[model samples]
Target: MAQPYRPDDRSECVLAFEALEGALRCLKDDIARTERRCQEVRRAYRQLIEVAASDAELPRVEPDSRLYRLTH
Candidate 1:
């Protein structure tokens, strides 16, 4: 037969809860940082595309080209 489950002391339970809350807070911060970095990357990519489009010396893109497909 299995023994009945025993709960931890109140102090131990409180400590565990606090540790979990701290971990959750750290994870939320990491997610926020990643989202910010992604936005920065997207902004940079758009700026690069604008610069490329305005450059006169660059070869014209064909309709079938992958770059044309992506931009279109």
Candidate 2:
């Protein structure tokens, strides 16, 4: 009977290679999700600033916010 050709450390090498591939796939998915969330935040901010522009008497920032600076 004939036997299969195998490396001296075939089992360890195969498992390590599989683990590395899985980690790379997970990292790619995370990057895509993060980019989408960033786009959503940017759009909401643009809409808020546009609405704030209509009030001429306003200083473009809320009185309770950090833009209302204290004198140093």
In order, candidate lDDTs are 0.72, 0.66
Candidate 1 per-residue C-alpha lDDT over 1-72 given as tens digits, one digit per residue, 9 for 90 to 100: 322333567776676677778889999999999999977876775676778779988676677876554454
Q: After superposition, how far is residue 50 of candidate 2 from its true place, in Å?
A: 1.0
lDDT of 2 at 24: 84
Best by TM-score: 1
Worst 10 residues of 1 by lDDT: 1-10
Global Cα lDDT for candidate 2 = 0.66
Query: Global lDDT for candidate 1?
Result: 0.72
- Tens digit of per-residue lDDT, candidate 2, span 1-72: 223435577886787677778888999999999988877766776666667678787557665765333211
**Which has the greatest lDDT?**
1
Looking at candidate 1, what is the lDDT of residue 52? 78
